[model samples]
Target: MELQRLRDVFRTALDLPADAPVDDLHYQDHEKWDSLAHMSLIAALEDEFDVMIDTEDVINMSSFGEATRILGKYGVDFNG
Candidate 1:
């Protein structure tokens, strides 16, 4: 469920396939994930998890895997 939800955020951010691989995700890697899209992503993720992420985490969220790792620190167990 978490994975799917995370994917939904990515899909919305990048306008990419819903099932895009984690490794394929990157800032500016897609047309939709530019500066504005990055802010949108932070909002989307905060909304999805109901948790506030620090500015450091937002800056570090450059890829799907990185996002999963950062959220883990916020008590979000994506593996569960």
Candidate 2:
């Protein structure tokens, strides 16, 4: 459930197809993932999950898969 919501965040931010594979989506893979999009993504995620991510985690969240892990640190349980 949470992962799907996370996917929705990615989908909306990147303008990606709903069926787009998340795991393979990375920093260099999409042209839309520029600095502006990165900040938008961070804002969307923070608003969605109600968590404040610091700079390091924001920098480290370079991919969709990594997003799951970083969000885990904030107690957003995708597995549940």
Candidate 3:
């Protein structure tokens, strides 16, 4: 559920299609995931997860999987 929500957030922020595979997405790799989109993604993630992401984590969140791991640090459980 949480994972799906994360994917949804990614889709919305990056303007990706519903079926777009976000798991392997990386910043700058996707045309839509520019610096502006990165900040938007961070804000969306913060709002969706109800957690404040720090600068280091923001910089570290270069990929979808990395974002999941960072959110885990904020107690956003991904395990079923």
Largest TM-score belongs to which candidate?
3
lDDT of 2 by residue, 1-80 (tens): 99899999998888788887776788867888888899899999999999999999999999999999999999999888
TM-score per candidate: 0.86, 0.92, 0.97
Q: Write down the lDDT that model 3 would get.
A: 0.98
Off by over 4 Å in 1: 17-23
Looking at model 3, residue 68 earns an lDDT score of 93
Candidate of highest lDDT: 3
Local accuracy of candidate 3 as per-residue lDDT tens digits, 1-80 = 99999999999999999999999999999999999999999999999999999999999999999999999999999997
- Model 1 C-alpha lDDT per residue in residues 1-80, reported as the tens digit of each score: 88778888878766677666645678877667888889988999999989899999999998888999999999888888
Which consecutive 10 residues in model 2 have the weakest lDDT in total? 20-29
lDDT of 1 at 51: 87
Residue 26 shift from truth in candidate 2, angstroms: 0.5
Off by over 4 Å in 3: none
